[model samples]
Target: MLIEPLLEIRDVSKTFPQPRTLLEVLARQPKRTLHALRGVSLMLRPGETLGIVGESGCGKSTLGRCLAGLHTPEGGEILWRRQPLSDIRRADRSRRIQMVFQDPYSSLNPRMTIAQMLDEVLFVHAPSMSSAERRDRTDSLLQMVGLSPGLKNRLPHAFSGGQRQRISIARALALEPEVLVADEPVSALDVSVQAQIINLLESLREKLGISIIFIAHDLNVVRHISHRVAVMYLGQIVETAATETLFGNPQHPYTQALLSAIPVPDPDIRSLQVGVQGELPDPLSPPPGCGFSTRCPFVMDKCEKPIPEFFDSGGEHHVRCIRAHSSTFSVPA
Candidate 1:
């Protein structure tokens, strides 16, 4: 029997309106909405890391914010164990789903010490806890993220980028959340630091058994931790598959282009950056057809037509391309 997913996102869409400039406002221009997410759907299995990879402005961050309830969707549903996420009580939701933001410095309060921040979180989430228990728990959280309890009284400014991020991770886990939405948790750190944070997250996931939605533009980073990967383009998921299956044999044009760009170790077999022509279309007025059609190397006449639905490549892999059924559209060697 198949186990139900911890989170079910079905056709969730989020749009943000552009604030009118003085000239536009004076001219009485029509308000335009940026389609941050359009009919996005995916299943986040319990205790599995689902990596979301995409170009900048492709709605990866927006999707994370939507999952964390920072931005409410304009359409569709987000289900937590088959129950509507919106209906869950605020405090209950906070404990169940937590988000570790991209920038640790910005996410943490400079005025509050590390211990104070952790204590505040515990107080809010577990108000019935005794002061002694809270302190114990705070120290445990810091240690769990590989930080010293002595630094608990230190400000965020005193910590390195990686240390600060660990604190951010610790804060997110303070409530013992079942799901963690990590949005580029290590992107701002040094290369060495990125590896450290990634290992910490992997260890935490294994130990805590918490499902993670890891969003990052770095394919290598996503590949290291994700059980499955979803590729997004222009506010929609163009392809999704098991980690190895996607890297070994990507079907979608956008996904293929992305994977091809990864550098290889062999000098004779250097990575080829597939010249995917054109740039991402403006979300304010997206193309009528597939979002990646303009950049797709295998473009066809029908590709310009609106895609009403996605085509499944196999039971495990899914692709939004109309040519998903054709083998000729495979990425060049």
Candidate 2:
């Protein structure tokens, strides 16, 4: 039996126009556009966590924002259970999808107390509920995220980074959203705090049976929590597969480099050194073909031409490199 995807992104593209300088304006130069997402496509199955991993500025956050309806895409369509996302009413969409930002402190309102924050969401989504009902719901939300309901009266400023993030999670769950777009939710917290939040999210997913799009550059964290993983490069997803498959046998050169960079604690075992070469391509004017072509050690002449399509290596393992289409293609030692 085939289980349909709960959320589907098809050929999505987004661009941000740079502000024109006075000199450029006077010279009649066209405004530069940053290609944030380029024909990116993926699927999120019901009750599964999908990890999106990439270097900084690889459009991971942009994709998360798009999923949560924070930013409108310039091209392509996102479907929520086969229905176009744009066609869904704002109120209905808010109840189904929620976002947890990277910085807990910045995402919360300092003036609003923990109770007030959660109450606001409930008030908006469940206006029919009485004040008593809303308060009860608020208390439950706090407790659900492993927070004390007694701290509800305190403002966001009074809480630590991890506590603030718990509040954020509570607020996001106020409406009982079916999908959560967690955009580097633990990145700003301390190392110890990061693990706590990660465990919290993992537990919440199990308890609520909610789908999650976990976006982050922390490969280790993603590997621990994600059922599947997608590797992004220069605003495009270069590879995607089951978590173990991707980490064990990465097909793309970029993916291989990222995995090789992971720190191996064992001094006895020497890890491969496939570090990526050169800097990321400028977003304002990305390369014509494969985004990693400029830095790929095994780049062929064809990699500089027409962009490659995803080649399925096996069930659920897809790679965007032209070389992956050939059975014998392997990264040189």
Candidate 3:
């Protein structure tokens, strides 16, 4: 039997209008809009971890926010278990999906103790619970993320970065969410702490059977944790495939370049470097056709005219480049 997606994003698009100057407004200058996400789509299966990797401004966080219901999309549909996400009640949605933000220090309340923070989540979501029950639940959440209940009374400023992140995870779990949108959860921590957080997230996924959308710029981390990976560029997904397939046999030029950038630990084995031509284009005025057309090494006349549709390279592998169908296509030296 085939299983349906737990969450689905169909042709989602989001744009932010640039703040206009008083002079520009008086002069009747056209308002410029930054296209953060353009016709992006993806699916997350139940109990699956989908990794979204891209450059700094490539809409990774924007996509995560959209999934967590933090930002409403300007276009397209986000479906939850075959139902529209907008139709879901806010309280129900919060209980089902939660977000672990990038900066643990900033995400938490500075004044509130850990217990107070967790208690707030439970108070809002599980108002039926008694005060004693809520206290017990908060302690359980702290213990669940590998923190001691004794630390619950401490302020956010007292903990280390990794410890604070674990606290953030605990707070997110207070609602018993089935899906976790982890937006660069480990990016700001120390290298050793990063591994610890990654293991914590992996362990939580296994123990709680929760699906995760892991977004980050770290390719190695994504490969280590993700079953499937999606490569985004300038508000569009250029390629997506299983972790090994995308790393082993990248089809899109942009994906190949990204994989090529991963450093080889051993100096004896030199890796082939694939360089992209130019900088990322301005989102307010993107290139006419494919977003990567200007920077792609294998660009052709046709790639500059019409936007390429996703082509199935094989099982579960999809590419959005026009050259995806070509048998002889390979990254240039």
lDDT of 2 by residue, 116-148 (tens): 888887887899999999999988888999988
**In order, what lDDT does every prediction score?**
0.90, 0.91, 0.91
Candidate 2 weakest ten by summed lDDT: 264-273
Which of 1 and 2 is the better model by lDDT? 2
lDDT string for model 3 (1-333, tens) is 656999999999999999999999999999989999999999999998999999989999999998888999999999999999999998898889999999999999899999999888888789899999999999899999999999889999999999999999998888889999999999999999999999999999999999999999999999999999999999999899989888877888888788778876644222445678889899999987999999987789989978899999888899999888777765554
How do all models score by TM-score?
0.95, 0.97, 0.96
Best by TM-score: 2
For model 1, the superposed segments whose C-alpha errors exceed 4 Å read 265-273, 327-333
User: Order of all candidates by TM-score, from best down to worst?
Assistant: 2, 3, 1
